[model samples]
Target: MSVAFIDSHMVEKFVENSQAFDKCIEERFNMLDMNQDGVLSRDELQNDANDSSFVELALQSKEEVDSLYDVLFEKFDTEKKGGLNRNEFGLLMKEVMLAKAHGFGETPVCVIFQEDSLLRRVV
Candidate 1:
């Protein structure tokens, strides 16, 4: 079908796809937000996920991921509030997906799942 032939409903289908993605993202954000304070700190981020050392996540060196948290915290915390909000968390998730999709690097199990499917399913 031509783009002109499509209607609002067709476009809405794409919007609807994001519902699941938003849910998943929110769930993850909640998981990361241990205090229910609606944001992530360096210590909070480091402790979540598996029992593995900080190095196990995203397959990066402890120095890399550790440093990344500092960078990520600075970057994602656009408000400079010292933590990541849900939107910021989603951005981080997208970054992980894109990096893995392009074979740029490895990721943690939570992020390593069928990323393409998750990305498309999200939006």
Candidate 2:
């Protein structure tokens, strides 16, 4: 019923192995490749429909998805220049997978950036 519980259950159902997980990552990479240039940009990531699919899987709504993106774009904008590099995007994906494994429900995967940071502070 909780995000964590949903995340764990989904991971169990969908991410049974490393290959499966890699496939998910690859799918995400392809989605984020908005320009088809084989690279990802902050605008592409922020506006990606593929990114939305993960949130939809996690069962979040459009407004929630938007808010989540706002937070991720803010944090991953490491240079405060307003965008994420591939490395930052990869880190975000890693955290999402970890959260899924840990059974965290999805407000949105992007929300994980803020939630994880806050959770770490609390812990």
Candidate 3:
């Protein structure tokens, strides 16, 4: 049987326990920052065997992961910046986590490119 990708109740509980989620995100961020770079690049942040830890915790796809880099380059590149800086990086990470969390499910969440909206059945 295919495992359900996300648990809505768990997410609700996660939101209810905001502090816990914050801490979890903080720790997850640290773990994602391999090589001690303090910032995550597309290559560094992309899902891989080495970084499969997030696979079990979050439901994601290769396309979504790749698209994230594209979105980051498109939106957060204020000042025509070539890449994300520390602040931009942090915001990007937060948004990604939120989007992912919002989209968690058995099937990959369809991300609406127009407003970057997430479409899913929460209830």
Candidate 4:
């Protein structure tokens, strides 16, 4: 294949992957929203806290949800809006994925992003 054609194909693939990633994030966030309000409240996050596996991946345990809420607010709620919308959730998840890929397996959601900003930024 010609170099220009390969470049075009690569761009198309990148766009497709990005869209898929966004859709996945949206689906996950919507599931967590619980109120269909397009943002995550403390109560909504409590749902995940109640789920043992989810809490394990997110913070620590259901008992630590209060602190988990604070960490999420500080890290993901970049606008200081008191709740996280889909975009923020998606961005935060992107950082989470990077953290996982970088040998930080099951550390905790808060710790994953707070220690680094480079992984969260898209460029």
TM-score of each: 0.60, 0.47, 0.45, 0.60
For candidate 1, the C-alpha RMSD (Å) to the true structure equals: 9.8
lDDT of 2 by residue, 4-123 (tens): 213344554454455655555666677668777655665686565444344562576768767887888777757665656556666676676566557555432322332322122211
Give lDDT tens digits, candidate 4, residues 1-123: 111112222323333477766766766687788889888876776776565334364655555667767887899998898888888887777765554444533232222222222223221
Alpha-carbon runs more than 4 Å astray in model 4: 1-16, 55-64, 104-123
Residue-pair clashes, model 3: 0
Which order, best to worst by TM-score? 1, 4, 2, 3
Inter-residue clash pairs, candidate 1: none
By lDDT rank, best first, the candidates go 1, 4, 2, 3
Off by over 4 Å in 1: 1-16, 49-62, 104-123
Q: Identify the candidate with maximal lDDT.
A: 1
Q: Name model 2 segments beyond 4 Å from true.
A: 1-31, 36-43, 50-52, 55-62, 104-123
Model 4's number of clashes is 0
